[model samples]
Target chain A: AQSVSQHNHHVILSEAASLELGCNYSYGGTVNLFWYVQYPGQHLQLLLKYFSGDPLVKGIKGFEAEFIKSKFSFNLRKPSVQWSDTAEYFCAVNAPLRAGNNRKLIWGLGTSLAVNP
Target chain B: GEEVAQTPKHLVRGEGQKAKLYCAPIKGHSYVFWYQQVLKNEFKFLISFQNENVFDETGMPKERFSAKCLPNSPCSLEIQATKLEDSAVYFCASSQGTLGGQPQHFGDGTRLSIL
Candidate 1:
């Protein structure tokens, strides 16, 4: 079984401040990592994902997450966050490239980010 | 289209009553998943259906939780004799099954409140 953990429960930041949210998983084999965001009343949407190739994966809204396999971390980062970026971000993990029944996602508790103007 | 559609944005039910949630998966998608998000806890996978057949239901509480997906109809998750612990946002997501590089499309979720 695979599990995901997000260290931050809540984060407060001022506009233009940099952002980083830590995510780690417990799977030793190959895995897929994802970052999803939910705005005030919006549905959860995919921010980025990492499967293979480059360790650094860039997503929409200037968000990027780096996959550090050795550390078991895929931390989400943004150089400058805007007020509109205040939302709940979740880190999710899935088992490696199995043909079937391996695409189920295990999600983290989510990190609430509040960017004050 | 919004990819996935979940009905009754919010639902309120009394204990010992029944609550039902509906999810319409995106066209051409064969995989549908249900998850519950309780306060202070991460989203827990409830059940998953590949087309009309259930693929996995290990996370679903067998005693009180039941789900079904019919042909040409949206999938439904029903809770019999609901309890306070059932209060949470239930999300429905769909994907292209066990394929490569496909992400789940989530709905806004139906917030279930049991009194």
Candidate 2:
């Protein structure tokens, strides 16, 4: 079975501090990776995705993630985070599209991030 | 911006009552998905639809859960005889197509509480 794991359950950091959230997936085959963030009282929004090329991907709010195949990890990073960046983050994976059903996402237990100003 | 609309942001039901949730996918999106986020549990895929056809329902509980997507209308998920354990936030999402590498856009989830 394919599964995703997020190491941190909750993280606290001060404003302007660098942030890194760890994510790992257990899948033997090729997989598509994604990071999504949900602010308080808001919908889940895409932070970044890695489909095929470029392991290093940049996304909104100065957030970026690197997909390391050898490490089986896709860690989200930010040089500086703001208080507004406080939100829950989720990592997801989809198996390489085969023939039949390929639309479902396998999600990790979310990590709640709190950035204090 | 791509948007998926979900109705009844909050719902409360009795132990034996039924609960229903609705979702409308963005125009031109062919794939619709439903997920359940229970406390202390990871997000679980409930079902997926492709143009009113059931694509994958393996994650759904066949006994009490049912879903349908009517032509030219929003999709609906119905849970019969709700249990207290059924309490969770249900999310709806849509994507351009189910081919591959398509990121899904999610809607504000409907939080369901069963007493």
Candidate 3:
């Protein structure tokens, strides 16, 4: 079965510290990668996605993710962190839909980031 | 509209009672997906629809869970004989094109508590 993995379960960082969350998928074929963030008491919002060319994809709120095909990884990064950036982050992958298969987003166990001021 | 709308932001139900969740996909979106987020922080895909047709229901517990997406109406997920373990947040998402490559836009989830 295909799966997504986020090695970080919970992370705490001081304000202005750099942030990096690792994400890896098990599938080898073409895949679509996405990073979503859910702030406290807020709905999940898309941070970034990688569909095709250009392995480096930038997203809103100063977030970016690099899709390394060789490693089957799409890790999220931010140069600096703010208290407001504290949230739960999820990494998802949409693997190619095979015949008789439903193309669904396989998700990782979310990573909770707490940015302390 | 870009936002997918979900109704009944919160629900409380007794064991064995029925629970229903509704979702309205963004306009022009053809693929709709339902996911269950348990307390363990893992998302379980429940079902999916492409227009009025069921695209994928492999994750659904067929004996107790049922879903439908009818024309001109909001999609619905219904659970019969709800169990205590059914307490979780359910999210609905939609995408514009085919399921493989399209990015899914999610809605504010419906939190269900089974007592």
Candidate 4:
């Protein structure tokens, strides 16, 4: 079965520290990668996505992710973090559909980040 | 600015009661998906539909959970005889296509609390 894995369960850092969250998928075929963030009491929003072309894709709120095909990973990164960036992050992959079924996203266990000022 | 809309931001239900949730996919989107989040953990895909047809329901517990996406009507998820373990946030998402490589747009989830 296809699955997505996030290494970090919970992370804490002082403000202005750099951030990197590792994400890996088990599928070997062409896939679409996505990063989503959910702030407290807020809806889940798309942070970034990687479909094709450039491996490094930039997204809103100074977030970016690199798709490394050889490693089967698409890790999210931020150069510097702020208290406002504290949220739960989820990595998802869209694998190709089999016959008679629509494509669905395989999600990783979310990582909760707490940024201290 | 495409957005999927969900109704009933919060719901409180008693054991064995029925719970229903609704979702409206973004305009022009043909694919709808339902997911359940327990304790803010990984999202469990419950069901998906392409247009008015059921595409995938392997994750759904068919014993009590049922869902439908009718043409010209909002999609709905209904659970008969809810259990305490059913307390969770349910999210709806929609995409332009049902095939691979389409990023799904999510809606504000409906928080269901079963007592």
Candidate 5:
């Protein structure tokens, strides 16, 4: 069975601090990795996605993720975080070219980050 | 429409009552997916449809859960005799197509509370 793991469940940091949320998946085949953020009282929005090619992909709000196929990890990172960056971050993977028609995104448990202003 | 729309932001139902949720996918999207977020972080895939056709239903609790996506109408998920454990946020997402690595666009989930 394929599963996704997010290392941190809750993280608290001061504003302007660096951020790194670890994400790892168990699928051995090719996959599409994605980072989604959900702010308070808002829906999940795509932060970044890695299909192929470049290993490091940049997303909105100065967020980026590096896809390491060898480690099965697609960790989200931010150099300088803001107070508004406090939210729930989710990591999802979709393997559309796999065996079946089940194109569901296997999601992680999500990481809740709190940035103190 | 460019965003996935879900109606009735919140719903409350009795343990034995039935609960129905609706989702309108993006205008050009061909795939619609349903997921249930239980413990604020854990998400369980319920079902998915590809243009009114059931694409994947392995995750659904067939005995109590039912879903459909008909032409010219919003997709629906209904639970027969809802259980207390059915309380969760149901999220609907849509994508242009299933092929390749198309990113899914999600909607503000419908919070279902079964008392």
Candidate 6:
């Protein structure tokens, strides 16, 4: 079965500090990768996604993720994080369109980040 | 609508009572998905629909959980008999395309609390 793993359960960092959250998935076929962030009391929003193109994808709030096929990893990174950036991040993967009746996303447990102001 | 809209931000239900949730997918979006977010930030996909047709429902319990997306109306998720474990935040999302690569846009979830 396909599975997603987020290495960090929780992380703490100071404002302006660099941030990196690790995500790895186990899937033998082509997959669509996504990183989503949910702020406190807000809806889940897309941070970035990787399909068939460039490995390095940039997202909103200055967040970026790199897809490494050999590593089966798509790690999210930001040069500097603000207090507002504190939220839960989730990594998800799904087989590209061909897998009929199996298009549901396989999600990681998620990483909770706390940024001190 | 520009956004996927979920009605009733919160719902309180007694044990064995019925609970119903609503979701309105964004205009022009043919794919609708429902997910349940429980403790530990775990999200479980419940069901998905493609223009009122069930696309995938393998994740749904099917015993008491039922969903539908009817024409000219919001999609609905209904629980026949609520249990304590049924309490969770339910989210609805929609995408314009049928491909898995299409990004899904989400709505503010509905918080269901069962007593």
Single out the weakest 10-residue window by summed lDDT for candidate 6 chain A.
A95-104
Which wins on DockQ, candidate 1 or candidate 4? 4
What is the TM-score of each predicted model, taking all chains together?
A: 0.95, 0.96, 0.96, 0.94, 0.97, 0.96
Weakest 10 consecutive residues, lDDT, candidate 3 chain A? A94-103
lDDT of 6 by residue, B10-111 (tens): 999999999999999999999898999999489998998999999888789969999999999999999999999999999999988766688888999999
* lDDT values, one for every candidate: 0.90, 0.91, 0.92, 0.91, 0.92, 0.91
Write one digit per residue (lDDT tens) for candidate 5, span A9-114. Answer: 9999999999999999998887889999999999999999998899999999999999999999999999999999999999999845345343889999999999
Please report how far candidate 6 places residue B103 from its true position, in Å. 0.6
TM-score of chain A of 2: 0.95
Better of 2 and 6 by lDDT: 6
User: Which ten-residue region of model 1 chain A has the weakest summed lDDT?
Assistant: A95-104
Question: lDDT tens string, model 1, B1-115?
Answer: 5479999999999998999999999988888989999993479999888899988888899799999989999999999999999999999999885764578999989999999
> Residues A11-106, candidate 1, lDDT per residue (tens digit)?
999999999999999999878889999999899999999978999999999999999999999999999999999999999987553554546789
lDDT of 5 by residue, B1-115 (tens): 8889998899999899999999999999999999999989998888989999988887899698999999999999999999999999999999885464788899999999999
Q: List the residue pairs that clash in candidate 3.
A: none
- Which TM-score value belongs to model 2? 0.96
Backbone clashes in model 4, listed as residue pairs: none
True contacts kept of 2: 0.72
lDDT of 4 by residue, A7-61 (tens): 9999999999999999999988878899999998888899999989999999999
Q: What DockQ does each prediction reach against the true complex?
A: 0.60, 0.68, 0.57, 0.61, 0.61, 0.58
In terms of lDDT, the poorest run of 10 residues in model 2 chain B is B94-103
How close to the true structure is residue B58 of candidate 2, measured as C-alpha lDDT?
77
Hey, what RMSD does candidate 1 come out at?
A: 1.5
| lDDT, candidate 4, B1-115, per-residue tens | 3688998999999999999999999999989999999988869999999898888888899699999999888899999999999999999999885456677889999999999
| Model 3 lDDT per residue over A1-117, tens place | 899999999999999999999999998788889999999988888899998889999999999999999999999999999999999999999856674333788999999999999
What clash pairs does model 5 have?
none
Report the lDDT tens digits of candidate 2 across residue range B55-90.
788789979999999998889999999999999999
